[model samples]
Target: ALQRTPLQHEQSDILEQQARDEKVALEKATDQGQYFVFCDTAPLLTAVYSDFVFGDTSLYPRARELHARYAMTLILEPDLPWVADGLQRDGAHVQKPIHLKIAQELRGMGSLHYRVTGSGEARLACARAAVLAGNTHIAATGWRRTI
Candidate 1:
């Protein structure tokens, strides 16, 4: 025997429609651009957060689908030590699982590139190196830079 979850109400349908429309716009822009556009959040992570932690799943499917359309994904490693900043944090314990889920989902998407570890200039240099490496890869593959 099987059970089924009830269909989502009108709000979820509206949100899914909005996400689809936005993804179409972004895809149009991305196709028109020369160099690549870099983004911090891959959007699917937001979907994951919404589904698992944030008590909302309305936009998850659309967001996850659009994120899979991205050319590449860079995931910053989360091995750095943390201090409670007294603001803007849910503590590392809460965040670590979310971070791991992001990594897992990104891996499932098959485009993840993990950033090198360390802090300050070391991390900065790692980021720069990743971009440079991406550029080199593009050149080697005969792709044009967008930015």
Candidate 2:
């Protein structure tokens, strides 16, 4: 098995590679005529994480450019229970702060985004409504639509 490097010790080269990989995926999806590419994560998050952990801004330019290509971004809250995934996730303690940073970054870029909350079916319903409405600004109720 390949040795798993701890996230904190992840090198710049690997991080850059991850961002490039994400870019390729996004481009491939767009080229394939995928109208709605549902990425569970993206370079934006990678940039945010890198900045948060290593105080690096190298990924921001590329991340911001890629972020603008998205029609909408659904920022899920850390309301769900935390499960350990070794080297992938930090901990529940970091979720809120990281989430806030993501929102701040989105707002800074003036990207269309929404903060999604709730669990299970309710969560799905909220996200579905946001996507289906295709509204620039989803009204605040259980979710917060931000521009």
Candidate 3:
């Protein structure tokens, strides 16, 4: 809706709503006993955007809480050519900066994240490898039963 609507990306109300939606979806996935719930971007990313665009940190606490529920986070690098995503994206130039901000935030939160980088099938392979590696780490650390 942010893409089609006139509402600005920095709008707090919309940001809050997006965070709430993410929380609800994550909760519902958990409630449904899903073994693996793949999220394109979580509330953590929403918090990143809130801070990056609006200088708002209001969503951090809740975003961090929801972030802890994830077994691992895959930070996909913006190495590929930018495809126009309507009004949702701020173009290719900002991709690296935004990605860095997200990495910094994840580090601050002490979250487990892997940077997935490559192109085409190689990128997918990298992500799959990361998932398998993360799963191994989770199992070894006895975090397997929780997810």
Highest-scoring model, TM-score: 3
The list of candidate 1 runs beyond 4 A from truth reads: 1-34, 54-59, 83-88, 139-147
Number of the top candidate by lDDT? 3
Cα lDDT tens digits, model 1, 116-141, are 66789998888778878866775776
Error of 2 at 51 (Å): 1.0
Q: Which wins on lDDT, candidate 1 or candidate 3?
A: 3
Question: Can you give the TM-score per candidate against the true fold?
Answer: 0.61, 0.74, 0.80
Misplaced by over 4 Å in model 2 are 1-34, 135-147
lDDT of 3 by residue, 2-60 (tens): 55423334555554565566566767877898656677767777777777766778877
lDDT of 3: 0.76
**True lDDT of residue 41, candidate 2:** 69
Model 3, stretches more than 4 Å misplaced?
4-34, 144-147
Per-residue lDDT tens digits for candidate 2, residues 60-145, read 88778766666788889888998877656777887888999999999999887777789999999989887876553434433431
Q: Give the C-alpha miss distance for residue 46 in model 3, angstroms.
A: 1.1
